[model samples]
Target: MLFRMRFIPLFFILLSVAAPQVVAHPHSFIDMKMSLSAKQNKYSSINYEWKMDPMTSADIAYELKGLKPDDPRWKQQEAIIMANVLMQDYFTDFYYQGKKVSFKRIPDSYHLEKDGFSLIFFFTASFIQPLPIANSHVEIQTYDPSFYVSMTYPNIQQITLPSEIAANCNVSLQEANITDSMRAYAFSLDKNDTVDEDLALGKQFAQRVDIQCP
Candidate 1:
């Protein structure tokens, strides 16, 4: 009996070690909106708002439930969440005249609120140097490259530009194309699998806001 008990524990440990990794999927959905404001014909900042689905909100709450905002643990958890998101470049991209624009730093302050059953995140990512909108073409896209979290802009009207720039620019929405090969490859991905090295994969799957000025 003693030998059998020891062997049983060892067997369970080995089984656990040999078990496959749990691949993550899109368990969270977000409805997103973006806005751009200009000052003196230069782009001032880009603002973003996101509303997470109830399931995702509930899952997130489960970990920090019962902890007040003032609690150290609560603050720590919030910091960790922000850090991870920032590490992903806030899941945003911008293009100017066919060249990519990179952010110099992440937003230092943001707002989080619980609205009914959903959790909302609001923040603004500022430009390192204001982009002049005069006679220039620009495009913006927001997406998760890993495909583990699905993001969508439900309303085309959610994208807004300042009144002055609106007159000089034309704005349109471009739907992302998911090719057959990409779809099949994405479907075949498992937990331990990494996405293709093609950095443009996110842009291919991301809805783009195209703006042209003359």
Candidate 2:
């Protein structure tokens, strides 16, 4: 059974202190890295690593204080975090040949660790149906729809592919095109403010990963 959602409090608490007065939409940041794995010419699973910024990490650490790895509370905390991401579809938009793709959660793959002052979340999810990659195009975008948190891959090298398909596939990163109006809009919102969910403010600033295999 999935754990009850307890991450909201943590999220809101972090956001409350993430920015002062002038900061824009993204109050917290997560550095992301992903690896794509394949089998029998079909893309199968994606492994994700998200490194929380120091401020966010500190908040999380305080919440998890004195909890040992073997503590049941540790697992509960992990489940809560995983559920938070699952509620958002893992913050991923995947497409194959222009059609949206779905994913299945791999609960056993969820884990967390500390990296210096940062906290890193690690998880894996498989496509509901593996997507064929031979002579096909695939696109993946990850972002926080609410724009409260900024998720980004620091560089193109952060994304990796299975070696067997690496040579056959051409990959590129498309940076988000943030317009002046968009910047202004983000700037106007304070930490307590929220953008309409329908607006998908974060998607406007999402970086896209495009892949083609010939």
Candidate 3:
């Protein structure tokens, strides 16, 4: 559910951190397909395909509605989106054995295009250390903390597992566990301010995938 109703003004506010803040609420909805692939039996990368809801796309396109596809406006918008996401670690989190996995590479080159009325973003977040098959259990989640944008995984069956590994691997999706106190605190922020990361309000509401290789 979208917490806030105002769209255009809120969109611009989120684009610029320096802009006047409002209580953070979702103005955009994203359907995501994420895949985990391995190279030589080690986890290599996490790829993302995000499809923005048509309404959100139209909201973002409001200014450049008539611009040519080759216009600099499109490029500028794409750059802005990339910069924002990069600054936020691509809205992704990964863990192995309860420790966070640091992403070593976030490529500058990404695919952005207008798919019918919606906008699509595709990219991969790579890690410096490949997760060994012996790791056995790993978890990955993606979300935007402030709730300015809500991200949902379209299907758990779409997630890929390491094929070359000897053990049987299974993938499962779990709903985020948001507590009453955390929920109350999250809504209290105004001007786009977010609760402390320790509360994990967004993560608690995000779609999480648990990988087990036995």
Question: Highest TM-score: which candidate?
Answer: 2
TM-score of 3: 0.74
Model 3 per-residue lDDT at 23: 47
Clashing residue pairs in candidate 3 are: 21-191, 22-191, 22-192, 23-191
Model 2, C-alpha of 206: deviation from truth (Å): 0.3
Worst 10 residues of 3 by lDDT: 1-10
24: Cα error in model 3, Å = 8.7
lDDT tens digits, residues 69-106, model 3?
57887666666666666776778889887788987655
| Tens digits of lDDT, candidate 2, 64-98 | 67887677877787888888888778889999999
Worst 10 residues of 1 by lDDT: 2-11
Worst 10 residues of 2 by lDDT: 1-10
Per-candidate Cα RMSD to the true structure, in Å, reads: 9.5, 3.1, 5.9
lDDT at position 22, candidate 2: 38
Q: Candidate 1: lDDT over CA atoms?
A: 0.67
Which scores better on lDDT, 1 or 3? 3
Over 72-181, each residue of candidate 1 has an lDDT whose tens digit, in order, gives 76566555555555767778889888988876576736666667777677777778888888888988888777664567788789888888777667999888878888
